[model samples]
Target: MQKGGPPPGRSSTTRRASPRCSAGTSRLRRVCQLRGLASAVGSCSSPASKRPCRGRPESLACRRHGRSSVDGRHRGCMEPPATVGHVLALYPLDRPRAVGAFDASTRNDNLRVVDAGGRQFVLRRYRRNRDPERVRFQVRFQRHLEAYRFPSASAVEARTADPVVVDEEGFPWTLFEFVDGEHFDFSRPEQAREAGRRLAEFHDVADRFVGAATASLLEDDVRRFVATPRAVVDELRDAFGIPSLELELQNFRRRLETIAASLHPERLDALPAGWLHNDYHGRNMLFRDDAMVALLDFDKLERGPRASDIVRGVLSFARERRGSRVLRPVFARGFLAGYRERRGISAEELAAMPALAELAFAPYAAICRMLQADHQDPVAHILGDLQGMRETEAQCAALRQILV
Candidate 1:
């Protein structure tokens, strides 16, 4: 819905997509495969037609809890091809044609992938509530990472050379050079080590890039999770039709409080504090074989206790999904080994790993609770994440062994 020309500091291009181009077809097909809808791609009509593609398809990328039917009941709404072409026309590129575009969005932000000149770039239409200043900080952070030769997306500067641009629709959009790699596969121990090593590198860079714009350590999240009222949990259970959800909620509250109490903030106050990729997880990374080719997403970037960042990654990359509902420890040893190879963890930080690992469980619980009231996707897919965290004794023991 971006309406106008380039922002104040940018130049503008106006080349548009051809009404019907063979190049468009190839792009569309690739996008379909990426979205895990090869079947739907077969019957997709022309972009000029403004018709919806028909198929019952789902995406493992977003891992959204929605059912896709022929009736258009589920799935994020796909953007029109012309709209995509229009957006691309604004940016300076050798080939302005938008061969194919797909909605690679999340619950809050809108992301569309546009293939041009045999390369991919992401156009992110940030949520209305997202702070522009913070987003600019993220843009600078990525540039800093790239400057240090870190594998990260390059934010395409506008004509004015500014990394971010405001579209005519008053929404902020930024284009990032796409990295061609797969999400981190935990089954590969080497990949786990590579991820850990790269993460240490990222931390090293972030440690020096401190500023007043960045918020302080990650206390708000812990406080918010602990403060999740029992009343809210009771209502969530009833709305989601879960019978014993309240009891589960009660248990989470107690455990989170215990962890918070045991891991005092003052002990980690002297630990490295700087900008952090608070949501460092597998889905945000790209791997070419066992090596990490790109690290993605920085929307939640903020100054935080550094060890908590590692703990967050361990919870994400080291856990293995068993069956449909359980996430067990299988890779933490390799991950910790790799991390310690590059960065030093203090005694205080090592002691707090177990607690921070417990704290990491809150987001899964919080996300499931928020989605419980929605009738959209099946709640099981989201709530099932919580089930994986229940095997805590084993996970805590695994963490102790790694930190010891």
Candidate 2:
């Protein structure tokens, strides 16, 4: 959630050039060059004549008007261009047909699918211009979770060995086994309790796998953002015209510096390292029959503070309340109970919660601001969230006063 600079490796806008095919060798090449049968007729054909040209044979005839012997029936050469929707329709899996598609805030394109067998799955396509290192880390993390028997959706198939499937148009695609469950509604206390318990279990198990070899997601984001908070702040100021928000961001950056400085070199050095599900949050989780069942979205997985994963759940679910109460204590208890059942949290660790919580929220706040600045109706969303968070702040203050 931190206001990091662009992700590592190449910017998401960069596109890899398609491999050049020899002239007139492949049908696709002919299609690209507009020299195929379809192009020729497309130029002179009336709109009414286009009605008969729906298939590949008609298209070939349109482009290569004089070549009667050119067979349109080649492997991988279909009449119409294959789109993501078309490819998904062709998914050989026995699931129900996809009825609709939804968009997420991330760079990935996600589609909801119901297979022929009435089962559901999510088809995610990563941006083709993603960081190779991040992509590798995500795939590795999936493998790790599979090995550890984590309650996460398994990867169905990737377009490439590298965990990305580049479409003919160069978009990267991947599919995940659909986790059938609802995301927890924080309005209910019981749900909060369950979320805590599941999150703790995730952290305890995830912590054991952390090793020195993996890259730290936290350090990466923090370093990137801290390096240029001023630029981000300036941009926000120009967009929002809120000087106070800019000051708050400056204060947030200073606090981050303080936390960074206070982090013990020895503790970090001694801390266990392994794959952390960097985007662990309520929305990324699925529940069935009143129990947490599956975790999804491992794209942000990386090596970092074991506690960082736990903190994501805390900040995400515990941060905002509209008409509801602050459920942190119940959540904290449930989470710690589950976590302690595997690996207990120490008093020192508990003391660090406030700082960690802030760190987790800062980047998220920045991301929300960024999105609002770029998109339509983002202001309404931001204002609504602010109102909710204000309510949550009052509830939290009251609860804290009582607890103290």
lDDT of 2: 0.47
Q: Can you give the TM-score per candidate against the true fold?
A: 0.69, 0.59
Q: What is candidate 2's lDDT per residue for 193-257, written digit by digit as tens?
A: 56666656666566666433334222245333344545544554565646445555565456545
> For residues 170-199, could you state the per-residue lDDT of candidate 1 as single tens digits?
445677776666776757878877878888
- The list of candidate 2 runs beyond 4 A from truth reads 1-82, 89-91, 94-97, 102-107, 127-129, 158-163, 187-190, 207-220, 223-249, 257-274, 319-328, 364-404
Candidate 2 steric clashes: 22
Query: Where does candidate 1 have its weakest 10-residue lDDT segment?
Result: 2-11
Provide the overall lDDT of each model, using Cα atoms, as 2-decimal numbers: 0.57, 0.47
**TM-score for predicted model 2 compared with the true structure:** 0.59
Best by lDDT: 1
Model 1 steric clash pairs: 3-169, 4-168, 9-160, 10-160, 11-159, 65-377
Off by over 4 Å in 1: 1-76, 100-117, 127-130, 165-171, 213-220, 223-245, 268-271, 321-330, 364-385
